[model samples]
Target: MRSLLARLSLLLVAALVAGCGADASSAEFNGVRLEQPYGVPDVPLTDTSGASYSLKEDREDALTIVFFGYTHCPDYCPLVMGSLSAAMNHLSEEDRERVNVTFVTTDPARDDEQALRDYLDGYGSEFVGLTGDLERVVELAEPLHIYVADGAELPSGGRDLGGHTTATLAIGEEDEAVALWKQDTSALEYAEDIHALLADD
Candidate 1:
């Protein structure tokens, strides 16, 4: 699983690097603005309320930022969420209203509705959380180039850390992903890029 995560991370880095050249001329974001924007994944999943939710059909904001991760992830997940939270803090009330953030769990077995809800509330009440069948989660992540896989089991009768891509995606008004941020991107950079995207929108 570690090897798979490493390989996926490398592939994501390469993809971002390639995307940089594709949109460099009209660069308007701190994050990589894709030349060929991705269409939002339309797969079905359950929201924190245990109700049906579809990313493509249910979004109500002009911009939606999505991240795939699990609550048990010891490092990257929390760091990215914290950065996003800080970025949200940097936005004006009106600007914040125009944006939506969604966290999709890669390990649904351990990330039930209540767990997801509790975890996300610490970040922001408005942040959405999605979890369901693992296969469905993988299907939802496929088009976005985010990988997800199970890991080995631990001695404590539990599973080891799972494999998943750490990149965060920014979907625009037309349900196309306009930009992506790497794990290391700072909160201020996200704030600036988000403000620019909103201005352009």
Candidate 2:
């Protein structure tokens, strides 16, 4: 897992650097600009409100930020969520309204609707949480190239809820992923990229 993360981090860094000098036709972003945009996953999952949510059909805003991680994650998940929460705080009310964030749990056994809701409320009420059968979750993540795997028991007796890709997908107005943000991206960067995307729209 450590090695996998290292490789993924390197790839993310390369992508970020590659996007630094985007052409006038493209919106300059702090995130890695995808050469080929990814369409929103067509799968439906159970939201915190126990309602079925489809990323492809039920997006509430023009831009949707989607991430897949479990609340039990020891490092990456909390850090990313905190950064995103801070980023949202930095946005103007209008820009905030143009963006929506959704967190889909890769560890479904422990992340029921209420649990997902409780965990996400700490980040932002507007942040949506979703969970379902692990197989279904994998189905939702596969198309995006978001990794998910079975966990292993930790040395401390706590279980590590497997491994998952830490990159966040920024789905644009056309239901396609226009950019990717690495796990360690700063809140200020997130806000800047979001504002730029909104401006382009």
Shift of residue 133 alpha carbon in model 2, Å: 0.8
Task: Pick out the ten consecutive residues of candidate 2 with the lowest summed lDDT.
Answer: 153-162
Q: List the residue pairs that clash in candidate 1.
A: none
Query: After TM-score superposition, what is the CA distance of residue 30 in candidate 2 from its true location, in Å?
Result: 1.6
Number of clashes in every candidate structure? 0, 0
Model 2 Cα RMSD, 1 decimal: 10.8
The regions of model 2 sitting more than 4 angstroms off are 1-28, 150-164
The TM-scores, one per candidate, come to 0.80, 0.80
Error of 1 at 81 (Å): 0.1
On lDDT, the candidate that comes out on top is 1
Candidate 1 per-residue C-alpha lDDT over 17-134 given as tens digits, one digit per residue, 9 for 90 to 100: 9889767854556788888998877898999998999989899999999998878878888999999999999999999999989999877888899999999999999999998887
Clashes of 1: 0
